[model samples]
Target chain A: MKGMTIIVQTITRLVKIFILLYGLYLTLTGHLTPGGGFAGGVVIACLYILLTLAYGRQWALRRFPRRLAGSLDSVGGFIFLIVACLGFGFGGMFFVNFLERFFPGRPFALLSAGTIPLNNIAICLKVAASLFLVFIVMAGARLLEKKDRTYDYKQEEEE
Target chain B: MIQLLPLFVAIPLGAAFLTALAAFKARRLADVGSALATGALLVLAVITIGRQGVYPVGGFLAPLGITLVLDGFSVLLLLIVNGIGFLATLYSISYMERYTSKYKYFTLFLLMIGGMNGVVITGDVFNLFVFLEIASIASYALVAFGGEHEELEASFKYLVLGSVGSGFILLAIALVYGATGQLNMAGIAMALAGTDKHLLIAFASVLFLAGFSVKAALVPFHPWLPDAHPSAPAPISAMLSGVLIKALGVYALARIIFNVLGATPLFGMIVMGLGVLSMTVGVILAVGQWDFKRLLAYHSISQMGYVVLGIGLGMFILASGGDSVVAGTALLGGILHLANHAAFKSLLFFCAGSVEFRTGTRMLKELGGIQEKMPVTRLTCTVASLSIAGIPPLNGFWSKLIIVIATIQAAFTYPGLLVLTAVTVLVSFVTLVSFLKVLRYVFLGALPDAFRKIKESPFFMGVTIVSLALLCAGMGLLLVPAARGAILDPAIEALKQGLGYGSRVLAGM
Candidate 1:
C-alpha cells in the first residue's frame, strides 16, 4: 500500500507541475490570444486538485497552506490596484497604459500587450490559488464524516 | 478616474479567484483574505464616487476595445456592492463556523461580489452579461450550499428561471448588436442616435425589461426568491437579498433604459406597473410566512418594487417633459433607497443568522423568547426592522418620504399619490407585522426549553451587525446637499445623460 501510494504521489506531482507550467504559459501569452487570467487560473487550480486527490489532503496542505495562498491572492489584487494607481499618478486616467511610453508601437510581442499581460498574470495567480484553497478546505472536512459514529466501524469492517 | 476604473472589477475578481485557491490548504485564510480585499474595495469605491472617467482595456480606444466607466452610477453601485460584501465577509467569519467548508463559502461569496462589481463597472454590454452570469451562477451555487433537499429544490428552481432570464438578456443583446453593430454601450448609443429603428428599439427595450425584471425578481417573476433566499447560509442570504437582485436587475435595467436606450414613456409605464404589482404581492405574501428568512426575502422584492416605482415615476416625468427637478428628486429617492436597502436588509439577515445560530432553528413557531439572551442581535434586528418599516429617524423613512413627495410633485394626482401612499403604508405595515412576529416569537415570549443557553454571536459578527445598524441610522445623511452632490448626483446625472453617453465616451477617447 505504501509503495502504491508513493507511485501515485510521484505521478500526480509530475502531472501537477506540468499543469502549472501550462497555466503559466497561457497566462503569459494571454494578450496575444484568447486565453487569459480566468482560464489560466482554473487550470492552475486543477493542478492543486490533482495533487490533493493523489497525495492526500494533508500532503497538499503542507505544501501549499491556506495562509500562503491568501497572501498570494492579496498580492495579486494589490498588484492590479497598484497598476491602476500608477496610471492615476502618471497624469492619465485609472488603468491607463503608462508602460506605453517605454514600449512605443511594439506590436503583438510577448510583452507588447501593455498592461493586459500583467493584469492576466495577476488574475491568474489570484484565481488559481483561491480556487485550490476552496477545494482543499471543502475536501478536507470530509475526513470528519465518520466521526459521528452512528454506525459502528467494526460492523462496517465485518461487511 | 479612468486608471482606477478597472480596480472596481479587478480587485474583487482577483480576490475571489485567490480565495478559491487559498481555501485548499488553510480553511480560515479565505475568510480573512476576502474580508480584507472587500474592505479595501469599499474604501476605493468611497474615494471614486465623485470621480468620472473611462479606462480602455489594452491601448485600444473605446470603440475598438472594452472600457470600464466610473461615473456616478458605477461608483454608487461599487460602494453598495463592496460595502455589503465586506460586512458579509466579516459576518461570515463567525456565522460560518458551524458550516463544514468555510473556504468554499468565502470563495463563492467573493466570486459573487466580483461578478457584481464587474457588472456595475463594465462599459461593454456583453461584458455586463458575462459578469451577471458569473454573479448569478455563484449565487445559485451558494444558495444550495447546504446540499439539503430543500436547498437543492430552491437552487434548481432559481437556476432554471435565472437561465431563462439570461437567455432573454442575451437575445436582447443580440438584437441590440444587430441594430447598431456595436457592443459597447456608448458606441451603440452613438450608432442609434440617427437610426430610424424606433420600433426595433422599442422591441429590444421590452426584451431588456423582461430579462432584467426577472433577474430583479419583480412581482410576477419573484416566485423563486422566497424559497432560494431562505435556503442559503445567513450571510449569503443577506448578500443575495441585499444587493444581488439590485445589481443584476434594477441597476442594470435602469442603466440600460435611462442611459443607453433613452427612457420612453411607454417603458416608464411598464416599469411602474411591474413595480406596483411586485410591491402589492410581495408584502401580501410576506405577511403569511412562518420562516424568518423567508419573510425577509419577500420584503426584499417588495422594497425593490418601491425603488423601481420611484425610478419609473422619475422617467415618466422626464419623458413627458414635466418638472426635471421632480424627476431628479424621484430618481434620487429611488437610488437612495437602493443603497439604504442594501444596508438595512443585510443587517436584518445577519440578525436572523445570529438568532438561528443560537437557537438552532429559523422557524418562527419553534422560537420563543431569546431577546434577553442575545441583546446585541435583538437590538440590531429591531433597528433594522424599524428602518425597513420606514419609521421616523431611520434611513428608510427618508427615502420613502422622498418617493412620496416626488410622486405628488409630478402631479400624478391624488389618486396616484393615494395608491403609492397606500401601498407604501401596506408594505411597511406588513414588514412591521412580520418582524413583530419575529420579535414576539424569537425574543419577547418565554424562552424555549431548548434555547436556555443561547449566546450572542462572535465578536466579528457583532461588529458587522452594529456597523450596519449604525449605517441604517446615518444613511439619511445622504439627503444632505454635499453628500448628494458627492454621491447621488453623479448617478442621477449619469442616467439623465441618456444617449449622450455615446458622445461622452467618444470625447474622452
Candidate 2:
C-alpha cells in the first residue's frame, strides 16, 4: 500500500509540474496569444488543486507552504508595480511601456512586448495564490468539521 | 510623483494574496498582514493625490495600448478605496473571528480591493469591465460567506441583479466598440467627437446608466442592497456601503458619462430623477427597519442619492453652458461627499459589528442598554450617526451644505430647490430618528438579561472605530480653501475637462 501511494504521489507531482510549466508558457506568450494573466493564473491554481487532492492536505502543505505562497503573491504584485514605475521614471508617464526605448529588442520575441511579460507573470502569481488560499480555508473548515463532530450534533439538536 | 501611481493597486493586491497564503499556517498573521497592506495603500493614496499627472501603462502611446491615468478624479477614488479598505481590514481582524474560514475572507477582501483599484486606474474601457467583474464576483461570493439561508438567498438576489446589470454594461461596451472601433476610452472619445449618431449614443448611455445605477443600488434598483449588505460580515458590509457602490457604480458611471460620452442635459435629468427617488424612498424604508445593519444599508442608498443629485446638478449646469465656478462647486461638493460618505458609513458598519459582537444580535428591540459596557463603541457610533445626520462640525454636514448651496446657486427655482432641500433635511431627520432608536434600544434602555456577561470587542476593533470617528471630524477641514484646492479642486477639474481626457492621455504618451 505504501509503495502504491508513493508511486501515485510521484505521478501527481510530475503532472502538477507539467501544468505549472504549461501555465508559464501561456503567460509568456500572453501578449501575442489569447492566453493571458488571468487564464494562466487559473491554470497554475488548477495544478495546486490537483496536488492537494491527489496527495492529501499534509503533503501539499509541506511542499508549497503558506509562507512561500504569501511571499510569491507579494513579489508578483511588486514586480508589476515596479515595471509601471520604471516607465514613469523614464519620463514616459506612469505605466508607459519604457522597455520599448531601453530594451528595444525584437517586438514579438519571448522577452519582448515590453512590460507585458512581466505583467503576465505578476498576474499569474497573484491569481494562483489567491485561489489556492481560498481553497485552503474552505477545505480546512471541512477537515475541522470531520474531527470535531460537534457541528453534526448541533445540527441534529437544532433540527 | 508619477512613479507611485501603480502602487495604489499593486500594494493592496500584493498584500491580499500574501495575507491569504500566509494565513494557512500562521493563521494569526493574516490580520496584521492585511492591515499593514491596506495601511500602506492608504498612505500611497494620499501621496498620489499630491502627485498630479497621467500615467500610461506599458509605455505604449495612448489610443493604441492600455494606459493607467492617475489624475485628480482617480486620486479621489484611490483615497476612498484604500482608506476604507484599510479600516475594513482592521475591523475584520477581530470581527471575522467567529467565522470558520478567516483566510478565505481576507483573500476575497484583497481581490475585491485589487479589482476596485484596477477599475479606478485603468485607461482602457475593456480593462475597466474586467476589473469591475473581478470586484463584483468577489463581492457576490463574500455576501454568501456566511452560508446560511438568508445569506444564500441574498447572494442569489444580488448575483441575479448584478449579472443583469453587468450584461447591460457589456452590451453598452460592445455598442461603443462597434461605433468607435477602439477599446481605449480616450480613443473612443476622439472617434466620437464629430459623430452624428446621437440616438445610438443616447441608447448606449442609457444602458450604461441603468447598469451602473443597479450596481450603485439606486432606489429603482435597490431591492437587493438591503438584503445583501445586512447578510455579509460586518467588515464586508462596511466595504460594500463605504466603497464598493461608489467605486464600481457611481464612479464608473460618472467617468463614462462626463469624460467619455460628454454629459448631456438629458443624462443629467435622468440622474437627478434617480437621485430624488432614491433619497426619498431609501430614507422612508430605512425608518421602518428593525435590523441595525439593514437600516444602515438603506441609508447608503439615500446618501448616495445626495451625491448623485449634486453631481447631476453640476452636469446640468456645465452642459447648459452656465457659470463654470458654480459648476465646479457642485462637482466639488459631490466628490467631497463621496469621500466623506466613505468615512462615516464604514464607521457606522464597524459600530454595528461591535454591537453584534457584544450583544449577539442586530435586531433593535433585542438590544438594550449596553453603552456602559462598550463605552468606546457607543462614542464612535454616536459620532458616526451624528455625522451621517449632517450635524455641524462633522464631515457630512459640510458636504451637504455645499451641495445645498450649489443647488441654490445653479438657479434652481425657489420651490424646486426648497423641495429638494426639504427632502434632504427630512432625510437627515429620519436618519437621526433611526439612529436614536438604535441609541435608545441598544445603548440607553435597560441592559438585556442575556447580555450580562458581554465584553467589549478586541483592541484592534476599538482602534479602527475610534480612528474613523476622528476622521468624521477631521474630514470637515476639506472645506477650507487650501485643503479644497489641494485635494478636491483637481478632481472637479478632471471631470470638467469632459472629453478633454482623450487629449490629456494622448499628450502624456
Candidate 3:
C-alpha cells in the first residue's frame, strides 16, 4: 500500500496534467487525425494509473473513488446512446447524424463530423473510467488474495 | 416499423447503462428496469412477426453501410430471444435477490440481450461477430458473477473454449473478407455466387462449422455446457440453454450456411452428423446424472441435436435437389423445435431453480415429494418434462413428430435418412425415460424429514414458471396452418430463399 519512492511521486505530480492534456488533444482532433476516443481514453487512463502507482491507494481513492468511476462510466455510455437515439428521434432512422444534415459544420473543421466527435468524447469518458475501475478492482482482489494466503499459512502453522 | 430495428439493440444497451447508474440506491430499480426493458422488447418482437424490411444504420445503404435486416428467419429468432428474455428477467427479479450486486446482474443481463439482438438483426458479417463478442463477454462475466471456486472454474473453461470458437470465426471472417472482398452478408453472397473460390469457401465453411458447433454445443465441441450451464445462477442457466446457444450458435450458423454461404450436400452431411452425435451422446450422458441442473444441461445438448438434425436435413434435401415439400417440412420441424425447446427447456430450468430455492439442494437424491408442497412448480415441471419428452399433447411432440415424418418422407430420396428417423424416435423415447426418472425421484417419492417445512418459490418465480408452462402447452397451436403461415412459414421461406436473400436485401435498399 505504501507506493513508490518520492522521486516517482514528484514526477507523476508534475507530468500528470500534460498527459491528461495530450489525451484530450487526441480526443478532440480524433475525426480529423488518426487517434480517436479509444486511444485517447487509454492514454488518459494511463495517467491515472501512473498517479496510482506513484501515490498510495488511499491517496488515489480520496481523489477519485471507485464509485465515481463506475457512475461516470455508466454516464459516458448513456451519453453515447443518447446521441444515437437523438439521431433516431430527429431523423427517421437510427444514427442519422441529424446534426450534420442541419448544421453541416465546415469540412475539415473540429466539429465537421457532426455526432462523430461527440461520440468520441463519450467513448473517451467510458473507456477511461472503466479501465481505471478494472485496474482498481483487480488490484484490490490481489491484495485480498495475498491476505488469504498468509492467513491460511498462519492457520496451518498453528494447527 | 422497420425504422425500429435498431431499438432492439439500443433498448437493452441504454437500459443497462441507466440501470448501472441509477439502481445503486433503490434496489427495485434494477428489477423494474430489467422487466420493463425486456417487456418492451417482447412487445416489439411480437409486432415484428410476419414483417420484413431492411434498416440502413445511419442512412448508409447496403453493400457499404451497415444494414439491419429483418427477414422471416430473424423475426423467429427475435421472438425467441425477447420472449424468453422477459421471462428470465422476471425470474431473476426474485432469484437474483439472493445475489448482493443485483444491479450489476441486471446490467450484464441487458448487455447480453442487446448483444443477442444485434447478432440476429445485423446484415453485416463483422457486425455479427462484434455482437457475438458482446454477448459472450457479458455471459462470461455473469458466469463468474458468484465469485465461487466452482463458478470461476466453470467460467474459465467456458471462456477458453468460447474464445477459441470466436478466434476461428474471426479468422474465417478475415478469409471471407479477403476472398469475397465484402463485409456485408448480401455483398458476400453476391460475390460468392459470381466467383469460384471453392478452396477458400470450403475452408471457411469448415471453420464456421467448428466455431458455430461450439457455440451451439453440438457434440464434438460441447465440453463446456455441462459445467457452464449448471454453474451459473438458474435463470442464467435458462438463458444460456434456451436462448444463447440458439441465437449465437444455431441461428448464426444456420444463417451463414443457408442464406449467406448457400448450403451444400457436404455441409449438410457434416451438420446432420454433428446433430445426431450430439443427440445420442447428450442423452446417454444425461440418463446417468444425479445432479438435477447438470441433467438439464446435458439435455440442452440433446435437444439442440434435434434442431440441428431438422435444419441439416432440410439443407441436404435442398442442396441435393430433393422434393421441396419434404425440405420445407424438415425446415418447419427444425425451426418449430427451436421455439418449442425455448419454452420447455427454459421452464425446466426454472423448475430446477425453484426446487433449489426451496430445498437448497439440486441433488436428485435429496429431493422428494415436493409436489404437495409446491404444486405450481410441480405442475409446471410436469408439463415441461412431458413437452421435452415428446408426450402426445405438448409442444415437443408436435415438432419431433414433424421431424420424424419429414425424415421418413425424405427416406425415399435417400434411404440413408431412415436411420436418422429411427434415431430421432429413439432419442425421444430415451428422453422420456430420463424425465420419468426425474419425476419418480424428485416429485413422486417419499418426503425427506429435513424438507417438511419447505414452501414454493416466491411470487415472481412462480409466475414465470406458470406462464412458461402455459406457453409450452399452447405452442402446439403454432403448428396450425394459420399460425404457421404468420409466424413459422416466413422463417422457413427466408431460409428457403437462400442466396436470393442477398439480392432481396440489396433490392430493398
- What are the per-residue Cα lDDT tens digits for candidate 2 across A1-159? 012376777898678778888898788889877898889999998888778877776677778876677667766776776776676577556666766655455746676766777889889887888688677655665312445453221111100
The weakest ten consecutive residues by lDDT in model 3 chain B span B189-198
Which candidate, 1 or 3, has the higher DockQ? 3
lDDT of 3 by residue, B1-509 (tens): 99889999999999999999999999999999899999999999999988999999999999999999999989999999999999999999899977888999999999999999999999999999999999999999888888777888899899999999999999999988988889999998888775554798889988988999889999999999999998999999999999999999999999998888788888898899999999999999999999999999999999999999999999999988888899999999999999999999999999999999889999999888989999999999999999999997899999999999999999997898899988999999999999999988899889999999999899999999999999999999997889989999999999998788899889983
Specify the highest-DockQ model's number. 3
Off by over 4 Å in 2: A1-159, B194-197, B411-417
Docking class of 3: medium
Clashing pairs in 2: A94-B55, A95-B56, A95-B57, A95-B58, A96-B56, A96-B58, A96-B59, A97-B58, A97-B59
State the weakest 10-residue window (summed lDDT) of model 3 chain A.
A150-159
Error of 3 at B252 (Å): 0.2
Tens digit of per-residue lDDT, candidate 2, span B3-63: 6666766666666656654677888888778878888888888888655666555556678
What is the TM-score of chain A, computed separately for every candidate? 0.79, 0.77, 0.86
Q: In model 2 chain B, where is the ten-residue run with the lowest total lDDT?
A: B411-420
> Candidate 1's chain A scores what TM-score?
0.79
Q: After superposition, how far is residue A74 of candidate 1 from its true place, in Å?
A: 13
Over the stretch B1-509, how does candidate 1's per-residue lDDT look in tens digits?
45556766667766665665556688767877887888998888878877888777754678878888778888899889988988998888988888887877877787798899999988899999999999999999999998766887899899999999999999999988888788998988898875664777788888899889889999888888999999999999999989999999999999988778777777787898888888889888888889999988999999999999999988887876777888898898899999999999999999989888878899988987888889999999899988998998999999988987887776553245566766767777777877777778777887878888878888999999999999999999998999989999988988877788889977873
User: Which candidate number has the best lDDT?
Assistant: 3
* Model 1, runs deviating above 4 Å: A1-159, B194-197, B412-418
